[model samples]
Target chain A: MKFSATTALAGSLALVLGFAAPAFADIKIGATISETGPASFLGDPEAKTLKMLVEEINAAGGVNGEKLELVVYDDGGDPNKARTFATRLVEDDEVVAVIGGTTTGTSMAIIPVLGDAEVPFISLAGAVEIIDPVKPFVFKTPHTDRMACAKIFEDMKKNGITKIGLISGSDGFGASMHKQCLAIIGEYGIEVLADETYGPTDADMTPQLTNIKGKDGIQAVLNPGFGQGPAIVTRNYAQLAVGLPLYQSHGVASDGFIELAGAQAAEGVKLPGTALLVAGLLPENDPQRAVVVAYKEAYEKATGKPVSTFGGYAHDALRILVDAIKRAGSAEPSAIRDAIEGTSGLVGTTGTVTMSATDHLGLDLSAFRMLKIEDGGWKIVE
Target chain B: MIMRLSSKATTLLILAAVIAIAPFFFPSSYYFRVGSLIFVNGLAVTGLVILIGYAGQISLGHAGFAGIGAYACALAPIHLGLHPALAAILGALLSAAIAFLVGRPILRLKGYYLAVASLGFGILVSMVLSNEAQLTGGPDGMAVPELGLRAVLKAVGIDLSNTEFWYAFSGLALVLGAWLALNLYHSPTGRALRALHGSEVAARTVGVDVAHYKLVAFVISAIYASVSGSLLALQNKFITPDVAGFMHSIEMVTMAVLGGAGSVLGAILGAAILTTLPQVLTVFQEYEQLMLGLVMMLVMIFMREGLLPSVAHRIRGRGE
Candidate 1:
């Protein structure tokens, strides 16, 4: 044991020395991700796709005739880890850009590192504040809770739902909805009859559902979630036998949610997902239809599985950044930042993205397509 | 033990000198920035040495205090209309109060009970911070008001780069904290706490107010954590709930243990090493967490007495 310990130190010393005199390195793009931990539900797959996407970028003659070297650090869905990784990337690796933060909380932790470094980043976390206070350098790919609120309410308006009830996850995701649902629904002249919340790892959202069900004029349901919270809602919504339209946040719109919620429980449950999720059901003439289908084919061929919006987003995120780098003809962070800000009509598997100087969250309400679960498959409702 | 001091002090002076003068060799301003973070983290670990090493009590929730300090910077201006410096003081006071209240009950419990209770307390604090949107701006995080200290210093003919200021300031803070902790290690109360650590029952038989000494350590450590957290937020100008999370608390403990928790200087060194290691290991970014876990386990396995104390003992024995 003593010998091995000494040898290990020696090996690390050698490794350090080896790094001192390196060849001209590739454009180091760092990503802080949750490769392990509870949120690995999303982060594990996100990590896998990050690797594949970087490999693909390099294989295609690389970006700007230089191989794209991706440096990813696992945050384990932890804010401290994300902060540590972010600091390391900016200070040590001196990477040109940063990407990925699986959980909302972790992304929040990394804000200081990016802000201090002024490194351009494309954050995978869906929180608006992650980009809001410090724009120009930070960009987010996913839609915000406010947009989700708007999209869900828009569907409620279409369905002639005058009264609504809300259930949300008890952590940051739930708290965002709890605060915003009333405001967003109020704008549509819809009344919120009840607001309920469930713990993130809770196996049952029934008591919350039962409370919401008791409220008068409850014509529909709205639940915001990412983990099992939505699945619990879907199951409880069915068991209650109350025949009212249910509107869910896009978090539960994943195929895994449907499978977990069971087929019968999912029907008529509406959400604001993308055509990319169930592109097979999208019309052939739809613009995103072809892009999504190609992605599904490529993803399936590579991972030997069906394509998720996760893989789609991961692919698009790297593509957009690499495209920006190639466009700028330099790996300098400011140039890439400017190029990203000016991006318009860039089509991806999900939808056309357009970023502006003011708004780093590139996706609009239109980026989402309203869908209702029908016949065990998500079909367009509007 | 008498002879160990001369050798240990020499080693410590050498280490401090290296850190104080190391930036001249930095290849870029970036190195200065990273070195500043190491110093900042080292300051926090120095506080942990007082709690974990001298007091011989455990706290699995120091990060909650850090959150208090960070959010104070972020929330003080927006919520209470207070300046950032006063907010930092407010954060430290709040952390001390909270630690005092929680430590009263938990400090009496030994071993895993204290660990679990402290862990629960930390999780609850973090949850409220994340869930309370109206006040904390929720999990999306809020911008911290910038510290005008450097600007103030500039007005007084004190010219320093942001990186240089943080490195020097954090280094000074760590040195002050370490000096105080070292003094306390030799004080009457410190001796009592160390006696209690050796045997709780024996401590009581010898007229040691074990509970009071333990609570004092907990509160002081919390104040240290809060100040470190404030320094972090002020430097970065952003704050988030993640500051109070479980992993951060664990990382603090790990650094304390790695540095030879018995001495604040050793803890600071541990903090510096871990802080810089991952930055240099960018090529193995994917394995960063795995490496941390491995290093922590290896250190705990072999370096039972900790990095500084153990190494000093070996050198003293060789000299003898």
Candidate 2:
């Protein structure tokens, strides 16, 4: 097609000038998600869930008699762009609360910007550092890697497993979880007999698995990674006939992992995951059962896609933020922030949240349910 | 000669006026942040103009220098006990030294060979930054200390908002970068660089050390990229290894080429357009990438000489 410089210039000019902020008496909630890049699997559903919740909330006559205006910017998983968007959300959109930061990098990048602005930010990323020291304005909804490690070790302790081989992807999530697990393994009376790591894009993990399998006293194997790495490890474990129970981190708490690793190979694999992964399996009286079931149904029906734990993080974040905003009795940033901090006994998808000044995540080990892959689906194991 | 001097002065004047006056029209402080980002990118692209436009040497891994600069800012304050401002200088010096060393060998290669060699260097830097989780925070990245100049300015009764402070600081940096680059354009070394760019053999016969001039341009450009990275790290107070990623190096080159690689003003305009395009296109949401690609494609098709130079050529054509 023939193109003209004048046309391109005029088009760009129109786009730049086309942004006209509408007058809104509603509360503005902002988000900066990694909506379109390498982290899109996490951020796409997150953006969808946030948009769906905002619609649902507004449809129910909004929060505190005011409609919610969600200003979401796609950062394309770039931390620098995420920082810019976080600043824009606070300084330009003037949002009372933000519910994003899809990746750990983006979360850390956005944290200081929101902290400086004193705008309450509930990140969806699963990183312990996001709230370890506990920034005043930063909160997260997902269970952290540390919590995941503790949950896995608790299961192993119950099983009377004393020694295990540790294999992790050298990516951010795996490395952090590996460190967290090692730090607390001594408390669990478990010895990591063999610890190994594979590169993120390593097509074959057989060498690492072989090395771990050769350890004499290893009772089980644990893979702490997300994406296809754990699936590859799982397959290699089965191929090598390791004859040991394999544990995976919450990073791969999805059906896709089973499908990728093959259902047969994935059978008997255990991991700590959110209740959203087993919404139908929860007992009727469980507090999270209703919330998770409702979110799963709504998300599935709206997007025609299966509900993921990633989206559940966004669901819990929005619900918590909106609930806090409602209880705060004001849309003031500091008020919303304090309300988020004081959030207690709030039942949501990730589990009942009870945030304190010292604990911004508000989720304990109970937030992660130990589930075994059985019959090609998740089976709640405790 | 007068015409050449006037053109240089005009470029600087236009750039300065835009930096000084654009904030007045900004709807919010967010625009100041975006403007500062453009200037930061412009500083780096100005440097590329020296390497690619002046010396005709292609570097596909200049972002490696940028990574060093950014990490230097993040690591220096805690490890070396240097102030953030001084850390930026340390970063620039380190980048220059690395560039000189790397350029010495790799600058011997021509065209695509050099491009691939530089690209490997960039990937190697990013791999280290990503793998060294203990120091660089791995892929999650590390927080950068504040430049702390704003507090000093406030103490002197000239307080500016964080975004405004960065906007003014980065704008001044860009102007200085452009001034230095324009000065180099007319200098004997720059002439030698340009002469080599035109014909290496002819320039060599005319006593122009082709290899030395190329190395000089490469080192200078690397310093510009490093300083740009340091400014970005300081202003945002956060950074990830993505600064040194291959895509960023491509972006620097794209900004220079798309705006008119041969001219400092043109390259800065390219940087401004590219940086602002993403911000403006975010309104497209899902279609943002499609629209961005389409715009860049169209610009490349129609403005073969790049956005600024082609338009300038048309204006000059009309003047006749």
Candidate 3:
């Protein structure tokens, strides 16, 4: 059981040599995902979708005759890893564009890296800050927290719900959505009767829900956060029998949320989600329906897992980048960046995407569709 | 390897050799980023070494100081109009003051009580950072103003790439920090701290001013963590409350213990191993955490004193 420094050093030496960047290919796209951490629910699918999409695109005679290659690294939800991998994707892999960042923090971590390198980075995480200040080389496919808030509020107004209670996790995603939801609540003339917060790892949210339920004149409850927190809140809310409309952020838009919260607990819950969730429910007239249906089918077939909104984000990012590459007629980073910014009316899994010099994330509030959980399935609410 | 060199000389040599040869081995900027990360973590853990190694005081919330240091860089330029460098100093002073104030009362408690108190301190700082949306940018985290030190260096005809600059800059900081710590180890104050660490009652009877020495160690370690945090924020140009989170504090302590918290070089070696291990394990993806746990467990079980100390002991012909 003696410690051997030489053996340990050799092991690490082999690790470094083994992972030395492989040969570069034409039309390279790189991605960093949280494939095995707190955000792995999002990253696992994101990695799969990127791998599957690249294979499909290359199989279809590549993008304009140049084979598309993907270089992916799992960031494990660590900002440091995201920064390092992002820099490597540009400097070592020499990718034309990068897509990834499964969490708001990791996505934001890569902003300065990609901005300084002047390479296009399409973030899959939700956060207005990712693109609000509008870093030149950064973009995202998912609707921002602001857009999610607006969509949920509009739905709330339609349902004649004005007074509501809010509970959010104290983590990065939850706190950001809480702020956005609060900022726009006044616009919809909705009054937040009770605003409560819970820690990300809190085992029970019943105290917060109980306080909200005790509040007078509260017609609905909104919880904004990703992972187990939202599921915990949903369970607690249903257990308390808080006879109010329950709303969630797009963060918990995946089927995993329902499974975690239990179908009975999640029933009648409304949230803003990407079109991919209820792709089968969309009518033929919807432009995104076909794209969603195709992506979901291919993703489920490729990975043998149910499609998640996170993967759709990556899928939309790749399609957007490929469209820009086609329009720019070059695989150069600068050209691809400009072409991506100038992108207009490209059909995507999320919705029809339009890019401009100012708006890095091209999707509008329309990108988010109001979905309700009914009978253990997502039903699009028209 | 077992040649008669002083530990200080050994530490300096290792630091110099790593700083000099790491760049040659770097395949790209990626390794530089990882290298900078190691130095940053090493810098923080070096501070912990002074407290845990010399003073025998355990802190489970030192990363809170790092959080303070990081947000100082992020917010000071915008709010106070202070330069980033000055902001880092401000952060260090602030961390020192807070640690001193908190240490005064909590340091009286022994073992688990002190650990709990420090853990609470860290949670409180992170909670404030996460809750104070207007100032700390809530949890989405605010952008840090560029330190622009590399640009300044470039103007002086010492142009280095971004990754290269961070790697060298952080490496220099770690070297400086380690130099100070090593010098302190031989000083009268360090002797007093170690006396208290061995037995506070015995040191008190010997007129060692037990509480004062412990506070000094705590404050000094807090400053070290703060400076490290500031460096990380400046390099990454991003700051999150997670820098001060419970897990980060655990990582800092784990790095110190894993390397041999008792020695400056050992602490740094621990930081390097843990930081590099995760990066290298990225290739394994799914098995990353499993392997990391296994390595940590194996090391703790076999090399009880940690990687460097145990290996050094063996090399020096010590008992198995």
Candidate 4:
């Protein structure tokens, strides 16, 4: 036993030395994405996008003469692990910027860690609070849930729909969007006739949709959540034939949702999504068309999978950081943070990002494009 | 027969040696993060050692206590103007009280029935934490105030980095928790609880108060989970309802059972393995859950009594 213990100790020392040797100075960026767990649908693409972009940047003469080194860790959708990895990235990896917290919970978990470490974190998640009480070192590329609510409501108003029913998930993303939807319903002159919620793992949301269907004067149904919940809701809505038009949040902006819900069930469902989803269909005169098209083409060609807004978040985050790093002319975390905050009118895959002292998200309602699922593909509605 | 130290002394000695020596193998502060994670989990598993190991009671929802403890650290300081440390204490107290109140009625059920009841309680707690957006931040989670112990240490000329500080702090907490648990194992109450674990009817016939002892174990374990949760929230400076979610509760149980729920050392061993294994598996990324499930299945199949006990049994081999 003693002999084995000594041998194990010696082996660990050798391993540590092996890791310590030949550390080159590279422009290191870190990411904690939910690559293999519940949020993997968001993270797998985001990780691939980040990896592809880092390679492309390095291949294209690096980030201003320094090779981009991305240190990616799969957080498994756990906040605790996200916090740990965030700390590791800042203190151990010494990364100047981080760019992928694949879920709202994981994103929020790392906010203080990166804020204190003074490393700039560009979150890919869409929770409004991630940037609401803006931490100086934190920014995100995705439009907030509040913005999604606004965009959906604006579209509903244009369609002469005023009375709506809400069915949100009981998870963090769902609850946050639900709150925002409630808070802003009055502003949109929309009455919430039925407000119901289901668990994240609920196999059926027909009961809730059934409740919404029974509500008098309900012009539409709005279900706000990511992952399997919205898909299940869509399937059940179609199964139950609720007949009311279903509006989903930007949470289900991915093609995965359409596939999961089945084409017929997901048909005609409207959502607010980033331009990445409709890059192929965008007109030549659109401001975001070029960048969106570039990212979508590069990403799809590299991964052989369709472009997703989740990946767009990572793409936009890295691009924003590179832009900031070029302007700042230093790899220092503090300088990168300030440069990122000072960003103005930088077109990203998501939208025109304009960061300031108070607004770290740098996205307005225009960042969202009203999209509908047509023939199992996304189509621009307006 | 070979002479051996008392179980309590052996457990403490092992814990001290492991905590003191493990840092030598740590490659970076990243390892410290993994270490602190293991200790926090170890602390919670140690609490389960009392309820599940000694009393032979199962709690599938102890993470509910952990959630309460974590949210307390996040909310109390913000709402009531208390220091973060004091809020942790308050969270622990609240967890203990809730455990006692809930345990009284639920402890009467046994086996799968008890499991279902505890599971319901956990689900309800997570639901409230998620649904009550006004207080709990409605799923985006709320930030915990800093504990400020590092500042105090800095003033005293004992500066330590955040990762280093949490690693030491949580390690010390685990040691303290293990010591208390070890001491309890030697107490007469411990004997009564163990007796009830052996056979509740037989224990009742022998004049042991089964309900009272079960409640005591439940409350004690709940306090353990609460403290562990507080430590986690204070360290990460964030709290989510997932802390109290059914998954976390299942993780606590799995850690205890996988290590040897009957032994404090075993429980800690279980926590250490489960906590560290995931961090190591983060490299593989895609194979994490598959690998974890395979490891768990192999352990259960080969070593029915858990890792430590089964390994120790093999070493002792036909002795005793």
Candidate 5:
């Protein structure tokens, strides 16, 4: 035991020295992700994707002839730890740019640290506040809850569903989406007939589903939630036979949701999801098809895990940062920030992202493809 | 009496020296942030030492008070138009009052009963903080207003960086917190609490007023936790519901017990170890949790009494 302990210590000392060795002009990119906690479902893939992408990039003669050095710290879904890691990334590692904030809380905690340091940060979390009243140095990759709502409402309008019943989880993602949907339901000429919510740990959402189902003249039902809450709601919705076309938010745009909700119950459910979810279904002429397919294939091949929309967010973030570095022709923080802001027509797994001075999240409602679950698989709804 | 006085001064002196001199050894400003976090945690653990180590009481929900304190800084500055400093005081007072009320009934229960009741209290606070989205920003958390003390210092020509200011401020708070706790160790109230801890029945027979002493310890600890929470919120400039979650309460107790809950210096050492361990262990990447768990298990197994106390015991044994 003592021998192994000494060996481990020596190994770590060597690793530290390797890291501390004078860089050969490598462009350092730091990330703080919740790789092993409550938010690990989102972050585990993100960390993997970042590692795989950096290795692939380095192997392909690196970015701008400089190797991309990646520094990642697992925040374990703790905001305090996230803040500390953000500080370390900015002050200690002195990274040119940062990516990865796996949850809204962690992203919010990191924003101030990165903003103060003037380091260009690309967050993976899906919160509107991260960009709204935007900080000069902060950006995000995931489509916001507001955009998800807008996409869902647009689809509902195309289907001629005027009035809908709303069921949402009281958790962060669910509550935020619920509020965003309510705010813009008027814009799409949709009115919510019944609105209900379930707690994060609520075993059965039957009571809430029943309340929504009881509402008259409701053309469809929209359940906006993440985790098992949505799965439970879907199960209850199927059991109740609400009959209206059921729509879910982009929160559960994974195969895991279908397995949890059962194939039959989730069969006809439609949700706003990224191109990565339906990469195989895209047309040959589509701009994002190549990008999404390449990412999906590479990610699955490397990790032996199915590609997720969450991982795609990190993929887009890293791609955008690299593209920005290439365009900037420099590794300076401010130059990178400006170059990121001026990003245009950069095809990524998410979409053909075109960031501007005013917009940090370049993806629009079009970036989300309306996908319906059919035969226990994702089918793109044209 | 002189020995006791010098011992108290010695602990304070050592803590102050560590806080002041540690900065010189820091490779970067990140260490300052980590150091400040350790001090904030140390303040809270010192309170737990009083409650669990001296008073022989356990609380698994002290983070509830911390959440109250943190949210107070976030909300009061905006809603009530109070200064951030005053908001911190209000948070501490509110925690003390709530602890007084909640401790009365729950402190009557012994052992696991007290722990469970306190755990429920913490869960209830976090639930309120999370559920009240409009007021508290829900689980996404809310940004806290600046404490403005740095600005005050700047006006007086003392311009430290944000991390440096927080390090000095929180370190000072920890020193004050430790001084008070060490003083309490030798006070009349401390003896009553310790007497009850040894044997409540015997203490009652000897006129210790067991209930009053327990309540006193609980309130004091709650205040300590509240102050610690305020410092965290002010330094981060953002507050989340997780600050008041069950995990945070467990972390506070763990830090106290893992250091030597019996001594002020020992508890601080525990806080330092836990805080720095996570930061240092991040280099292990995916193996971070495994490494953290292994380190903790090894420490508990080897030391048994905690890092500082066990080391001190070894040194004394060698001397003998």
Candidate 6:
């Protein structure tokens, strides 16, 4: 029972690396992001917001007499790299819980490894399948492709969109949106006039758009969740003068779409996401008001720029994981996972986050807000 | 016995033996996790050794075969009512068929032309896997049906954990794959293919049936890649387009070169080292790509024969 100095040192290192560095003398949570990939546009801000939130939590006297140490790994949207980082965080860093992988593909790759280890993970990637066949400790912070389809279709229905054409990336995000489009378009009394597809690295969508536009009587266009796919689609829609109510999946932010598509092309295009995008349009008493205000102030101070809801989810994911650690009162993975699942009425920038065993998604279908580009930015549809 | 190995093979044998035994002393299940990954990757690289080393043809899209094998497990049971194991076989068949077709046309091309053709083929496959949502579940990825091999084995009193099963299974697969490939290396067909690799026109003039041997090599290597892919997907219980991406294909090739592609065991050694090094190097996160690029450049340029071959040659010089 006489512990040697080596044994004591090893144990201390295990503790420090087991749940993370204890600089905060409190619970520490970790996030792995793609800070330098094609998806860094999403991952960099996410990392920044994580810092802002951790700082805010520490300033408010820390969590339950402990401070927040937010450890982050840049996945760069690679699956192999993500798995290695997950191990380093789980074994070397010993962080209580981990969050953030920019793309669903990378998120799905690490899900089993994280699950087998019982570490809680939250992803910001816009894929519902990330939560399906669910890992016990995994949760996602975005609306699903299916959910986005249903919401967009409902709005399309309300706006009398009956004849619609669909264009999607031939990638996973594109395929899901295509399926969702096929399923929801029918219910909204919408006919699929034309369906076209393009590759992920494709910089031009003109050929596919020409095919769709060549067909007669297509009244509305649904460009499913993608990056360059929407940019190409919107620009083509303008050049072709389709004049249709072109809707994009929530994955496409208004800023990029407008910048890529030109102002006239993006003038009436719609994208769906959590209300954090158009916080100014929500009622004063909206649940997101305080979160938006607080996050905006923090983000500007931290990064010296405007913040988007993508960053909001990244912040929320870290906060929720930390909150679970606090409630569990221990760094045990199973304990933290249960604490996260049972959390209810936890206010986040997106909405009230409440996850249960059956549903790992926090925000509901009602949480999606429809916004369009008016002058230069998103305008909440009146 | 050591002198009989040729200094290069002697060094590779030592390195391989060391890696095979090293994980036993791993302080935690974490190293086993990485060990199993190396085994999986080495299994694929072993297949590449037959193609790249023995046959002298290149496949920049072998990962596409891995995707087929992976999605076979993912899509088969859900759509076709097949078992995961059966799906793996079916995927292997699909890969062989595709390789046969793709090889027939582009195997005729040599050097950079063949490399670029294979690279294009790989990118196209990844795009299809990511884009075709209904069948393959595109970029979000689909969960693979668990292999249940371990579960079935356990039911018959063969109990194993996730890490242990993959570790032993992938290791066994590598050995078997290497043994088969080694057997082929000594076979008449293997000799004929190597003859063609040495000089295609000379082999053709000498009646080696260069095209036939090349096609056979392509299909056989494709099957190896497919089975490796199936094992990887089964091990993880998931599959994504990244498995079939051009980058993974290149990684497999680099691994083959790293171990001295001429030796199957050496290829596995290369795969094991590359797979495990990143785990240890995670502390140097920012320098990852830079380090990988540098290691690859230095190894290929200075150590043209590979880590094992060059080290073995240097040690032999000391004796002289």
Q: How well is each residue in B208-270 modelled by candidate 5, as lDDT tens digits?
A: 978889999999999999999999999999989999999999989989988888889999888
Report the C-alpha lDDT of model 6 over B222-292, residue by residue, as the tens digit. 88888888888888776777889887898899899987887776787788767755544444656877988
Candidate 4 lands at a TM-score of: 0.85
| Superior candidate under DockQ, 4 versus 6 | 4
Q: Which residues of candidate 4, in runs, are more than 4 Å off?
A: A1-23, A152-175, A181-249, A252-271, A371-382, B1-7, B21-27, B109-112, B313-320
Model 1 CAPRI quality: acceptable
How much is A376 displaced in model 6, in angstroms? Answer: 2.2
Tens-digit lDDT track for model 4 on B1-320? 12223667778888988888877766567678877898999999999999999999898998998998999999999899999899989999999899888888878776655577778888999989988888997666888888999999999999998888999999999999999998887788999999999999999999998889999999999999999999999998888888999999999999999999988899998998887666555555578778889888988999988989999999889675
Best by DockQ: 2
**Model 1: runs farther than 4 Å from truth?**
A1-28, A64-66, A80-84, A87-94, A105-118, A131-134, A206-216, A329-332, B1-12, B105-116, B157-159, B199-207, B280-282, B285-294
Docking verdict class for candidate 2: medium
Local lDDT at B43 for model 5: 96
lDDT of 2 by residue, B179-288 (tens): 99999999999899999999988998999877788899989999999999999999879889999999999999989989889999999888987887777666666676
Q: What's the lDDT for candidate 6?
A: 0.77
Native contact share for candidate 2? 0.57
DockQ of each: 0.27, 0.50, 0.39, 0.39, 0.49, 0.26
Candidate 2: tens digits of C-alpha lDDT, residues A33-68: 988888998999999999999888888888898888
Model 2 DockQ, alpha carbons vs. true complex: 0.50
Clashing pairs in 2: none
Q: Is candidate 3 or candidate 6 better by DockQ?
A: 3
Contacts from the true interface found in each model, as a fraction, amount to 0.24, 0.57, 0.48, 0.54, 0.57, 0.33
Docking class of 3: acceptable
Q: Residues A1-382, candidate 5, lDDT per residue (tens digit)?
A: 1222244346446555765343568899999999988899899999999999998988887788888888898998889899999998898888999998898899999999999999999999988899998789999998888988999999999999999999898878888889898998999999888988888899998888888878789999999998899899888888999888999988898889999999999989999988888889999998899999999999999999899888998999999999999999999999999999999999888777898888998987789899999989999997
Clashes of each: 0, 0, 0, 1, 0, 13
User: Between prediction 2 and prediction 3, which has the larger lDDT?
Assistant: 2
